[model samples]
Every structure is written in C-alpha cells, then in structure tokens.
Target: MWLNGLNLMDLLVKKLFSYPGRDFKSGRDTFAPFCKLDAKLNHPHSAYRTIHIGGTNGKGSVATKVAASLMREGHRVGLYTSPHIFDFRERIQINGQLISHEAVHRHLSHIFEEDTESLSFFSLLTAMAFLYFREERVDWAVIEVGLGGLYDATNVICPSACAITSIGWDHMEVLGNTLEEIARNKGAIAKSGVPFVAGPSAAPFFPQAIHVQRHNPYDLENQEIARAVLSTIGVHNPKGLKEKPPCRFEWRGDVLFDTAHNPEGFLRLLEALEYHFPGQKFYFAVAFSKGKDFQSCLDLIRPHAQGIFALRGDHEKLVKPEELNLPIEETLPEVRPLVVCGSFYIMNLKPKKGRETLGDWESDDGILSIQKRGE
Candidate 1:
C-alpha cells in the first residue's frame, strides 16, 4: 500500500550502480572478476540450493513463476529479483513472503562490516542472500541475474537447475551491442552439468548462441517449450506442480505482461501468444524508456493483439505518453485489436466504469483506443 520509495533502498541502488567503470574492463571477465570475493565468504555454512535465471526480459517473470511453483510445492523457496516497483524488499522472498526490512538491514549491516568499500552493492547483496538463505536453510533460491550473466554477482551460486528466459538487446553498454555478444554474457550462467532451460528465442546476451533443445521436442511457438523443459527434468510432477500455478497465457482478465524490451523478445511474445491462444483477444502491458526501441517492439506485436494499453509505469526510466503517442494507421486495416504497448504509467488514471481490471475497454481512454489526428 505504501507507494513512496525508500531512502535506504535508493542508496543501495545508487551504490550498486555506482561502479560503471568495472563493467567496461573486460568483455568476458568484466562481470566475473568480482566473484573472486566469494573465496572469503562462508561457503562452508551455505546450505542454499539455487536456480539462476537470465535474459533481457522475462527473466523476472519466469523466475517468479518457478519460485512460486516451488513454494506451492512445499519447498522452502527464496526468490531474489531486481528493480522492484513498489518495494525494495520485494526482491528477496521466502516462501513468497518478502524478507522483512529489519532482516535486510541486519544482513546488510553484518555484510558491511567486511570492509566492502571496494565491493559493488550487488556483490554484497549476493553474499547476503547466500548467508540469509543458508541461515534459513531454504530448499532452493531463485536468483535473477542483475545484468549480463557470466560476470553478474549472482552467478556465484552453484545452482541445481537454470534457465535463460529470452535474450535481447539491453544493457548494451555493459553486455554488448549485438545479440550474440549478449547471449555469451548470459550463457555464462549455464553450467556444463545442469539442465539449462531456455525460452524459445535467441537473446542479446547470447544473440548468436543457439539452444538446440537438448531435453525434448516441443514447438517453440507453443510456449510449451518451457513447460516441456520443466517436465523433462522431473521438476514438474514430482513436486506437485501440475495442478497449481500452471504456465499461464493470461492474467487478471486475460491480460499479458512481458518485459520484451528488445525486438527478438517482442517477436517471441507475439509468436507464443498467437500459437497458444490463437485469435483470442489480448490485452498487453509493455514498459520501456526513452533510449529503447519502443517503435520496433510495437510493430512486432501489433498483429497479435486485439487490444493494447501501451501502459506507462512509475519508474523514472519510462517513456512519456506524449512522446510514445505516435501517428496511427488511420486507414490501416484493423488486423488486430486497437491498443498501444508503451509505458504502464498510464494506469495512474482512475478506472472507467464497467471494465474488469480498469473498465471502459473502449477507445476513448486506454492507449490502444487513442486515435491520432489523421485517424
């Protein structure tokens, strides 16, 4: 219910992002060298198993689903994600409950005693998660890579299972300009022994890196690719994951949300929906900032969507509504529902009467319905 951001949370964010210089050092070793500090960590006492998830988008969502399902399966699950919208503590969850602020401070304070002046904030937190998870003796801890995979601090975990959600162009300055370069960064999270499950697409972290579907034969567009990976590994039914928390096509009114900031990820989202749901009407919520390719993403997914909200969120990195509001296809045939897929911030407007999530599914208010002057 609290909407205001926290001062301490802001401080930690600034501190973690403080070391831009380190990200530029070496392409391959750029992110990993920081992990050497793990030698000093209390690894002997660490009892937490892990699942490392990486990708440009969908990493968080996929990790959330996996962690949630694990918790629902009676496992002691801890989910550590990033870039929280409402609260910083949302990043670290135990059995679906966020680690308390008191716990965060206690952990951070204890770790700060280690003379971390040279350590990035992310490195410290990764250590803290390991320490906390060890203390809690969690069955599994789901770790979402902060940026590129290999060098990311979270890669320190020796996870039992892992996944690369969907790779695309993001953090280009740190990861790389090309998708192949990016995929290499993320692929570092993949180990030789673990079953690496990937989304049905190439990622900028490893743009040129191809995943040959070593597990089972599944249609890439079906979005069952992920489900199949889970099943093949015996994690699906062995832990009672069948009936609870299924891989969903829609949420809260058949609305779909994918952090497909890159063209590749966007294409996959559109394709997966078209394959899984077919001609069913869809509501999309997309968020991106100024420097991103919002235009290309919109163009890629436009055909599959029956309605698009082009949402705007509360993040400072979000693109403004006026700037995102581009000229429409006035005479353009309605191949799909009329909608915009921009920032989610537009939801700040009070809901219209008689709609499900926000009501008033008409063209007057939501971004999908906004008509250009020529239209």
Candidate 2:
C-alpha cells in the first residue's frame, strides 16, 4: 500500500474513530481537552460569525436552510452537521461543497502532530471544520449540535445567534429523563445577549429567546427560526432558503427518505406526509439506532402504514429487525409510496429494484437547490 492521498485520508478517518469519543464513555471533563486544542489552533472558530442550532429534531434542517440561504446571498458559508449518511466529508462543507480529501489529511496531520493527548472524534472534527472554515475565509458558519447542546464539542463557539428548533425526549440516558432537562441542555447553546430564536415549545427553555409562532406546516416553523437568526446579523432578506436538506421528507418517486428517529420527529414526518399525500397509506421500511424510542416512533406510523418492512441499519447499535417485532423483508415492497424512515444509517441499506425504480435515490449531494426564501 503506497498510502496515497486518498489512502491517507481514509487512515486518518479510521484513526479518528479509535479515539475516546462519542462512541465511548466519558465524563464532562472530556470537553476540557477541546479548549486546549482550540487555543493551539488559535481559536479559528472566532474568525467568523456563527449560527448555532440545537434541538431534539429539525435542527439539521434549520441549519441547512440557514447555510443555504446565506450561500445564495453570496456569502461564503460553512455548514457543519453530524452522523453523515454516506461520506465523512458531508459533516463539513463550505458553500455546499464537501471539504477536499487533501484538506482532511492535512488538518488531521497537524492535529496529530500538535497533540499531547488524544481528542474525541467529534472534538477533532469540530476543530478541523473550524480550521478549514477559517482557512477558507468563510463569511459565516452554521453549526448543528451533534448530541446534547450544553456539553457537546461544537458548543465551544460563541455564536452570533442561536436557535433551538424543538425539544423532545430522545437521549434520556445522557440528556436526562425528562423534557425539561433536555430543553435546558439544548437551550444552553444560547449565548448571553445573543439573539436566541426557538420554536414555540422550546421557548420556555430559553427564557430570553424569542419564540417562533406556531405554523400549519412543520417546516415553516424551522424556517422562521432561520429567518430570525439571519435578522440578528442584519441579513433581512434570506433569499433562496426553501430547499430542504437530504433525508428530511425527501421523495424519490414514491419512496420517502426521512431521518425521523424519535417520536416527535415521526409526528412531524407523518404530518408532512399527510399534508402532501392526503388519504394515502404507505408501506414503511424503518430502522433505528440505539438510545432512540423506535417503538414509540413506530407506533405513530403503524396505524397509517399498509405494511411494515423492518430494515437492519448499518450501525452497530441498530435495533435488529426481530427486535422491532415487525415482519423482516430482505427486499423492498412493490407497493406505491414506500417510506424509508428512522436513523440516517437507513441510507446504507440496499433496496431491491422493482418495476418502478425510484430515479437516482443515492445521488443526493445533501445540498438543496437554491430557491427564493419563504417560497
């Protein structure tokens, strides 16, 4: 093996997973290491304004919309999200472009060279994104919280604005067993005197934040938050913001790709499904990662599903098909309007091609087309 650029990048990514990161157990003290790394990196995150988004659901959508809107307005925007579906580079992008493989290798080399101790996978990635954005001289960065907000590695930035899309009980083990705890953790992303925008339910958690007025369409509420965040930075007209990120109710012919892993997310997904296709029942292909309330999510859609196709996801923590107590199918159904739901890992599942094949389902670049904001 010559360890070419591509090989080096893959090796660095593999080494990143070996660190004591999100996959392993650690205390709040784990966050302290990031501070040292940031200092050594010269606080690259401070070079540009940041918009922080955290919530149980809709945070990624809101982040993407905000980034897209900024990008369309001619600003060099960097978007950082988590749990990439296919590519590790998807987690960091500037103006909808994935970070180059060489950039990843170069940054990883620097981090390893300067490191006195090991950093978490997320911490290293977060540092790499901050460094890349700063080096790229991006005008703005939209960062999405990977897990709970309070102690998440991405929370180290002092954002120009903060938004919490919605609060729900999902990560009870780490984020507390109640909604209040989760809300507080998510709301902790709010900076002092920095304009904080939150969805109606999440408003109570951020006492000083402005609440988005509830709207009929669930995504409208997410857009409202993005608009509010833009307003704080004097960018009033967020043009071209209507596009939804990949896997948020995305449709390929009749099969829907949705990352609705929790109960509340499923509720919103069901609402969107109902709004678009009235009086239509769907055949569901669902999978979920560990720590998610898969059963409750399933319960929400079970009544409306014509048949349930349990899919085993690619993650190690994925809930097995047998655990779902639903019929496991090795292939996709011939039924119209098949829905692939739950974890982002569902994108990894291989669906058998039928008569009506959804066109280019896996080719999503994860960037939405530019459209007029509020369209």
Candidate 3:
C-alpha cells in the first residue's frame, strides 16, 4: 500500500479487530462494546469539538465534505468513518490524510497491552481513533455513525453540530421497516442541545405502518436541517454548496463508477447523473447488505439501470454478480455508456477485460487502466 513508516500502527489496526462477530440486533449491543473499550482509555481526554453525522446514506459524503470545509478553513481536523473500500485506516484520517499503518499499530498496541480480551472489533477500532484524535490535539473531528445513530459508539461525541444526511429503507433487521422508522433510527444524533443538519428526504414512501416514539429526528427535512445547522455554525453561504459534495462520482472513459448504495438514493444520484452525463446508459454494480431486501432494491433500480453488475463491499455482505442471474448480457448490447453503481466493490469489472483496478485493499494493486473495444 504506498504507506511510509510506522509498522506498529498497521499491526494495531489489524489486531484491533481480533474479536469477530456483531450482535446487530439493536443499538444496545453497539454501546456495550464501546463501553468496554472506553473503560481502557485511561488518559480519558475526550475533549474536542465534534461534528457527528448519521443517516442511511450520504452521511459519509457529508462528513467528508464537512471535514474538507473545515480543513479549508485551516483547522486541524480528524475524520473517522467506516467500511473502507480498501485500507482499514481509510476509516480514520487527520487533516485530510489517512493515518499510517505504523501509527495505527503504535497507538493500538497501547490498548492491546492494557486489556486484551474485552473489546469488539468496532469498539477497539473506535478507541484507537479517539486516542489518535486526542493525541494529535485536533481542532475538530468529524465522526460518522457506523450504523444507526442512537447506540452507535461514535455518538459519544459532544459536538459543535450534528448531521443526518438523508434517510431511507436500509438495515431492516436493526432499524425496523419503513422510511419513518429508519429515519428515526438515524435521527437519534439529534440531541437536545447540538445543532442538527439533515439532508433532504424523498417523502415517506411507506405508510405509518411503523411507529417510533415521539421526538423522531428524521422528520426534519434537509432544508430545515440546513437552516438549523447554518444558524449554529453561522454560515450564510448557499453559494458554497452549489458544487454539492461530489456525493459519489467516478469515471473511466465509458464506464462511470457511482457508489449509489440504496434504492431511494437513486433520485438524487440520477439527478446528479443527468446534470453530469445525460442520456448515458448505465451498467451498475448492485448489491444489498444482509438486512437489505436485495430484490426490492434491484427492482426499483432495474428500469433506470441498463443492467446490474453485482459486487460486494469491504463489509463482505454484498451479493455477488453470479448470484444475481439476471439477463445482464442481453441488456448490455443495447445499453450505452455503462455505469457501475451501488458499490465500489465492483471495480474488478468482471472477466470481460478493461474494468479492472489492479490493486487490492493494498494501494499497490494494479488497476485495469483501460479497455480496448472488443478486447
């Protein structure tokens, strides 16, 4: 991976995940693990202004944008996110750069030496991030919720602001079914005092079949969220938002990589596509997590998609292309300008030639540079 120095941090990152398995039944499980790890950060210096972002989709994007904007303002920023496309450290960054493996190992070793057995993979990793941020004395940190908000360990953040960027059907097993239910699950970051910024919603596509307790934060639309958050941050510039967090955009000649992960998210992504490359046929990389209703999401995207080319994410719950068994070949002959959407996992581009990213999780993996016609 083109990393320099510090083998210790790398070892720490890998070792941190020593405990396998997740009891994702609810937010409760998520907290317990973190609590166990938190008990170990003896220095206990958890002081830093935070920007906590949560949502089904776009949270990572918004978090990235927020961190970038903060960095542009010349603040020392720490960004912690999850499910890296490749490297584990992709999850933690300081001032716009990924932490070195050596640094990760050195930091993680301290926790390992203190208490070896209790921390879950997520918890251990989260602890490392907190330690690094504290040690570096960052001006601010952007923490992304790994799953739903309420119980997510990252929720430990006490921040200048909070953000929930769009909500929709996802993680049905934990968050519950229906948009409102899911939205509420994500909205938990809307604590009483912090400024909360939410992204736009496409409307509750589902009925009020599911009931969440009062004070559901997902109910706030993006505009309302923007107004609320702007007030807190003292930002009056909509002009700055015109560029719109590149959200998810990719390009390789005819093939475009758009990691549009869920169903409802297609609206804004498609809107972005129309603006960027109108009338292009899309060949997509589609997959659902264990909790996602794969076929339902597939059906929702089928019309807009030229054909679905399935792939997995680092989390490994993604559906494989062979498992899809859809009529992809037939659709491809007619579909122009193929797009690989839904997951970054599909960069391999299939056996057909030219859609390969030569590297693996390590940066040195060779990417399939280009595709020749009829190769």
The prediction achieving the highest lDDT against the true structure is 2
Determine which window of 10 residues in candidate 2 has minimal summed lDDT.
Answer: 366-375
Give the TM-scores of the predictions, in the order they appear: 0.67, 0.92, 0.76
Error of 2 at 297 (Å): 1.1
Task: Between candidates 2 and 3, name the one with more favorable TM-score.
Answer: 2
Q: How many collisions between residues are there in candidate 2?
A: 2
lDDT of 3: 0.59
Q: Which stretches of candidate 2 lie over 4 Å from their true place?
A: 1-3, 20-27, 116-118, 354-375
Rank the candidate models, highest lDDT first. 2, 3, 1
What tens digits encode model 3's per-residue C-alpha lDDT throughout 1-375? 656445544455556655654447645855865676676575333668777877776666556656656666667988887766555677778865677656676777777776546445666677788888888889888788888877777766667888766677777788877777777777777776666555555224212211112112221232344334444676544221211122145454455555566675555566656655577556665555554556656776666676665553344655654666754341112234666666544443432344442223233332211111110
- Measured with C-alpha atoms, the lDDT of residue 171 in candidate 1 is 69
Question: How would the candidate models be sorted by TM-score, starting from the highest?
Answer: 2, 3, 1
lDDT of 2 by residue, 237-355 (tens): 99645766667776665677788888988998888878777888999998888778887898899889998888865578788888889878755656667898888877655457655
Model 1: C-alpha RMSD to truth? 9.0
The CA-based lDDT of model 1 is what? 0.55
lDDT assessment of candidate 2: 0.80
